[model samples]
Target: MGTVEDYLGGLRPEQAHALRRVVELARGLAPDAEEGTSYGMPALLVGGRPLIGVTAAARHLSLFPFSPAVVAAVAPDLEGFSLSKGTIRFTPEAPLPDAVVEQVVRLRRAELGA
Candidate 1:
């Protein structure tokens, strides 16, 4: 299976940079989280569960928090970003803020009892 770095390497430089920032945020929030592929995208695993997955699409990069509740928890802070039940879409030029990323990770971590 391809590794997270391999997945990031395949993306355009700007996309990779943006995704890397998200990965960094996750890592900072959950230092014990493991990096791997989950649901065919680069993911961080904590307490044996996937915390978040990131995908690079043609028009934007997507962050999958893997829980609709997590999205809803951060809904107010997600102004101007495209959000769905499981994903938040953003451009490389306007990636989600580190504060937003931390909020998502914290919410997921709490939900998982980690």
Candidate 2:
């Protein structure tokens, strides 16, 4: 998708709704971020750099904070979620918690020096 909206638009209703929550959370943290793409996934860009990304997969949604270190730092708070070095995967049924998302965004902002 060329934009975050386009990506979110193509998902199932529930998935889109779930990801919109994440998108809003990220936007709140980085009020000046622009809609963009990173690693071919829809993202929020700050200073033209990816701060966070959201995606809908076949069976899961993902939040990409663009930093493996940020994922590690928030590891303790992310029990039960599927985590990779740079992504956190969650289902719409088990949506990512707002606090966790806040932590991710803040950490990414710091990492970006934004």
Candidate 3:
């Protein structure tokens, strides 16, 4: 039953700071996206569909771009970062770049027809 703010508040200072930036970037890209929880993670929903989700892990912060196609599109640019089928992992020390974040959001928005 926790909110996004509550989730962010529970993270360590560094983790929280990095996640806050991601959240800010998401909101900037999709102003109308609703803030809520998805699969126990803080997520943004556009047109009632999950747009993006972020998580604070022990070693790094995770960005769930919510699209495999988006991940594949950004894969070349993610050479130095750790990535999975759906999650892009980065450290608090070296947070995700703004451009990368924007690209992810833009792709997801397009996929959602937003």
Candidate 4:
């Protein structure tokens, strides 16, 4: 999507709210992150990298970690959550864990020195 609003438009209210929470957490972790689009989804750029992006999928919201290390580290907690290489998927009814959200952002910031 071209903008956060554009991407969020397709999401249900709950999904949008959860994605917004993740975005907010990431922004708090890295205040200098620049808002932008990546892979046709709303993304946050930190230290010249797309640190995180969220897509509104047909059945759930998908979050791209943009860092394999972070994904691997949190793989255990993500067992119940649908996931791919760097993506964590959750439905509108199953919002992501806040602790996991914070961990991802904080770890990424430390890794990127942001």
Evaluated against the true structure, the overall lDDT of model 1 is 0.91
lDDT of 3 by residue, 27-112 (tens): 99999998887877789999889999999888889999888899989989888899999999999998899999999999999999
Pick the lDDT winner. 2
- Candidate 2 stretches with Cα past 4 Å from truth are none
Clash totals for all candidate models? 0, 0, 0, 1
Error of 2 at 92 (Å): 0.3
* Candidate 2 to truth, TM: 0.97
Q: Which candidate is the best by TM-score?
A: 2
Assess each prediction's global lDDT (C-alpha) against the native. 0.91, 0.93, 0.90, 0.81
Candidate 1: where are CA atoms >4 Å away? none
Question: What TM-score against the true fold does each predicted structure earn?
Answer: 0.95, 0.97, 0.95, 0.88
* Residue-level error in angstroms, candidate 2, position 36: 0.8
Candidate 2: minimum summed lDDT over ten consecutive residues — where? 1-10
CA lDDT, candidate 3, residue 57 = 82
- Model 3 misses residue 15 by how many Å? 0.3
**Model 2: per-residue Cα lDDT over 40-59, one tens digit each:** 88999999999999988898
lDDT of 2 at 48: 96
Which prediction has more favorable lDDT, 1 or 2? 2
